[model samples]
Target: MKTVFITGSSRGLGLEFTKQYLEKGYLVIASCRTPEKAKALHDLKMQYSDTLSLIQLDVTKEKERDRAFDEINEVFDSIDILINNAGIISGDGKNLYNLGDVHKEDFMKVLEINSLAPLLMSEKFLPLLEKVTNAKIINMTSQNGSITQRTQGGKYSYCTSKAALNMITKILSNDLREKEITVLAIQPGWIQTDMGGVNAPLKPAEPISKIIELVETKEIADTGKFLTQEGKELPW
Candidate 1:
């Protein structure tokens, strides 16, 4: 079975990805900040004991990331897919991330988790990815990141971070093209997650299912593109 590593597998889209992939018989290495507190992941672990491995990872901290990498490297030969799913939206309760309300500290915090962490994870796991054929790095970005698609602005930090992630995805694709590793920035439309809110038209399951299919089928030719859940290319 192909092995996939997913960050932020404790809940939301990340948890759904873990569930679906495990159901599809893929060996899943799921990481989150607090695995012990991740009741859902632990429950899934009970069912998928042989196939699932949970690791504690903060994603932002280098020491934790290094430890997680070493732990995985010790057992697994390579990882076929890396899903950069960990992200955050920093809000100071009063501010709505509007122009005047956007604080540097909040903006930087969001950037560190949503943008920088993914790049760091990809770099740290490059060796494991390189060992496999058709390896992929899937960055979970947002349509809010699209410069051409932007009509209104409110989520300054989240939007900026995802936009930066899109650029990182493109650059990484170019750099790793010769290595034949596919990289993509995927926008998983509004869904009923904590981030997306309950009023969202779609649910996590359907979008995540489509995303899994996209990951399995997309080729090197599709690298560096910003795509919707259906695998259609989106504007940069």
Candidate 2:
């Protein structure tokens, strides 16, 4: 059976992805910042039983990251897919910032969480990822990352961080091109969630299911290209 490791598997899109992967019969290494505090993930662990394993990963914390790396390295020698779903948007609703008022602290934190964390995780998991016969890296990016999609730009922190993440995805695809791995930059789209908020047009599962389909497909010429959930090329 294919094994997948997903970060930020506590709630929202992460939780949903974990559920779907388990339903599809894949062994899921689901991670949350706080395994004991994540009631939902804890419950899913109980429901899925042995199919799902819960672990704590703050992503921002180096010690936690190291512990997670060591534990996964010891437990699972290979991971078929690694989903970098852990991300943050600092100024979503509160502390409204215009172009001039973009708080430095918030911007730095967003970049650290959304952009740097994934790279760190990938680096740590390289050995485990390489052990798999056909490994894939999925960077959970956003349409906001696309310069073409930026019409009304306000959330500077989120937009900049996600856009940087898009670049990182492309870079990963290029770096791993010679390797037997597929690195994809996927836009989950504007789905209703804590980040997307309610009244968003698309459902959370729509983009997620699309991601699963894209990951399983054969590698095409567009290795480092950015794409939407529907497999359409997104202008970066």
With candidate 2 superimposed using the best TM-score fit, by how many Å does residue 58's alpha carbon deviate from the native? 0.8
Candidate 2 TM-score, true structure as reference: 0.94
Clashes of each: 0, 0
* Candidate 1: tens digits of C-alpha lDDT, residues 76-107: 99999999999876745444478878788878
Q: How do the residues 29-102 of candidate 2 rate in per-residue lDDT, one tens digit apiece?
A: 99998788889887877888978988889988899999998888787868989999988767344633458678
Clashes of 1: 0
lDDT of 2: 0.84
Q: Which ten residues in a row have the lowest lDDT in candidate 1?
A: 88-97
Best by TM-score: 1
